[model samples]
Every structure is written in C-alpha cells, then in structure tokens.
Target: MTQGASGRDGGNSLKARVKTAKSRTLASTLWLQRQLNDPYVARAKREGYRSRAAYKLIEIDERAHLLKPGQKIVDLGAAPGGWSQVAAAKIGADKPKGEAKGKVFAIDLLEMAPMPGVEFRQMDFLDPAAPQLLREWLGGPADVVLSDMAANATGHKKTDQLRIIGLVELAAEFACEILGPGGAFLAKVLQGGTDTALLARLKRDFAQVKHIKPPASRSGSSELYVLATGFRGRREATGEDGAG
Candidate 1:
C-alpha cells in the first residue's frame, strides 16, 4: 500500500497501520495503531523521553513558567519518570557545581529506573507516613509539587472521574502540607470538572487556580491539569475555633 508523509516509503509515506492479529482484540489493535501513528510518541522515542506524557508538562511549563532553576520539587506518582525528567532538567538538578543546582524527589508505587538528578522512592503516596517521609528526604518545604496519578479506569465514566478527583484532592492536601509559601501545585484532573468542594478549598488555599488542557493531551480524552499557584500556607486555628 502507498503511504503518506509520516511513513517510511522512501521518505514519503503515511502513518504506520497496525494489522490486527487473530488473537488481538479489536480495541487493543486500535490502541496499538494509534500509538504507532502518534507523532508525539515518535518524537518521545527520538528524544529519549520515558513517555509521551513528558510533552504535556513541557508545554504547560513553557506557558505557565512553573519550573525554574534552583527550585526544590516533589513529583508524586512519577513512575515512568517523564514528569520527573522534565522537573529535574528544568531545575538544573543534574548540573554539577553550579548555582542552578536543585533537587527533585519522586515517589510512586511502581518501580522506576533511576534517572540522574532524581531521587526515586518506591511507595504509595497515600500511605500515612508518606508526607513526612517526603519532607525528610527533601530537607525543606518544596517550591513545587507535581502529581500525574490516576487510578486504573473501571470503564465507567463517573467512577473514573471520582477516582481521579480523589487522587488529585489527596495530592493537593499533601502539597498544602509540604509546600513553602508561594509554592505551586500541578496535577492531572478530569475535564468533567473538579469537585466543587475541592475547587473551593483550592481557591481558598491558593492565590490562583486554573484548569489547563495542554495540547499534548488527547483531544478526545477527559484529561486536564489543574495548576494552583501561590500557596497561602496552612491556616492556623483561631482562638474561638480552637476552643470548640
């Protein structure tokens, strides 16, 4: 078959098409085809990124200016290390003997291969002990917190939305606890809209809250990112409230 521009037919070919095998489900075949044809996937492979998801963060940071040199960062659910890779590079974590030297701490339940300038921990962030452990490892409050975690989808839209919200909420709470004043939090959230209560809490705690759908995000997918900046620090109980 003749191919278009994206194929390897003497430099003028079309996207690669995956042929369905007898044992492969149609859904699986389609997914493979999409992956093979995705330009971002090909670019990621060429650029040595761990996953195509890296471009999402790269684009967001380009517009938002969230990552910076010499900033301490924590990346939750950083398996496959795409976001962690971006964070480390942006903050100059790998730079040796430079003023821009920074640190990146990454944690996830899934084991990830070690990357220079990132300290990886294999543990669930939901563990009660996790926050303190991360703090200890970081040596101080983080200038930024990032989370790209999502629960395995059950194929029910509502259930998936709720699970994603719950994960982001937990990550936000953790950010509030460990973030320094003026810190920023970025997390993956469903596009159906964040829960009202969670939105309210975020607004109360942050100076700015925005939902961004980066271009790298699939157009048909519900994935979005919530960027919350300027943490106000934890609220201290007033006397009357404490008395109660």
Candidate 2:
C-alpha cells in the first residue's frame, strides 16, 4: 500500500484490524466495525450534545467553572462544535437572558452550518489576519480561548506528536494574544505529556497550568487536556504582541 501524503497510514489499517477480529461482540463489530462504540456516544445522543466530546468540556468545567454568562470566547478547530455548544448553553448565548450576553466564536477549516449566538469563521487560524478579525468581532480581548485542533495525524507516531505540539503552541500563543486578565485556555495534548518549554511558558503566564483528563473522556484514549487559568495580563504573557 502507498503511504499517504501526510505519511500517517490511516489508523490501524483495515488488514491488521481484520486479522485480529475473531469472537468480538456485536457492539464492538458495529462500532468502527462501522464507528467508535463508546458508551458516551449513546449518552451524548440522549443528552443532546453535538458529540460525545462535549462531556469532556463539561467534566473540565465542573472543576474550573470557566463558563459564565456574558463572557466572550473563541473556539479553535471548532467543527462539529461540541464545546461551543456547551459554552453557548451555559453562558446564555443560546437564549440571551437580560444583561446576560455571551458569544462563542467558532473557527475551523471545514464549514459548519450555523449556531445562534455563535459566530462561525471558516478560515485557517494560522492566517496573520485571523486574530485581528476575532478581536474586531469580540470588540476587544476575550475571556477564554479553547483549542482542540490536532493535525490529521499519520500513524507515524513522532511526526504526529510534533505536529500536534505545534498546534498546541500556536493555540497557546494565540490565547496569550487575546485573553483578558484572569482569562483561561483549554487545549488537548498527548499522553507523552506537553513539551517542557510549552509547559514552562504556560506556568509563567497563567496562575496554574494543569493537565486534566476529564471523566467523560474515554479511558482508553491517551489524550489529555491542559487547562491554564488566570492569565496574569503582564508583558511577559504578551510577548507575541511585540510590545517590547
């Protein structure tokens, strides 16, 4: 078989999976037998979340309390927007209660239809102009920046890890650019853990940078999220701003 352009040979390859299949249950067979059969998938359907991943945000927020009415937020890599949905619901972005107004700016390379009180932007976040557009939309800095953007990984392991790290770094830098004092940043990272420099940078900027794997996240997945809260709003935190 030819290697994919990204060099990540799809996941687990169909042949390897078939070779291992034997007396698996129907549930296992159908799930990626047709799709991923996670119990959370079933629960998400009943609970009305866009995807099972929504619960991950809920679990993280349960401890952090990042969501609030009237806070401005930016959701990066927000296609099939599960996190944006939760932010909207919690912040009254869905219904707009009196004096309680919030907006979730959802951005992705892929197109999403639309969500009320959520601003959708289909653009490469790497674009130099994207931040300005977002700032204009929010009318200033934001209270939160959430990123779930992982590059389409090639099964090659190290390359994929590096790519994801790069994305995380970009998100962190962007968070620093746009977050107000006491702002928070949430991002996905791998089990090998975040790079030391990245971790160190977060620690210096936020009050605390902690790794959390929410209960709603599948036990089998190696993914974990880094929650960095309480932006110091200092010069060091805004290095990318070039105010030096």
**Which of the numbered candidates is closest to the native, going by highest lDDT?**
1
- Relative to the true structure, how large is the alpha-carbon lDDT of every model? 0.85, 0.79
> What are the clashing pairs of model 2?
8-154, 8-155, 31-35, 32-35
lDDT of 1 by residue, 1-244 (tens): 1232233534544767888899998888988988887767777777789988898999999899999998999999998999999999999997665554889999888899999899999997778888788778888889999998888888899999999898889999889878887899999999885999889888888889999998888888899999999888766532322111
Candidate 1 global lDDT = 0.85
Choose the strongest candidate by TM-score: 1
TM-score of 2: 0.81
lDDT score, candidate 1, position 192: 82
Q: After superposition, how far is residue 214 of candidate 2 from its true place, in Å?
A: 0.7
Off by over 4 Å in 2: 1-36, 96-100, 234-244
Count clashing pairs, candidate 2: 4
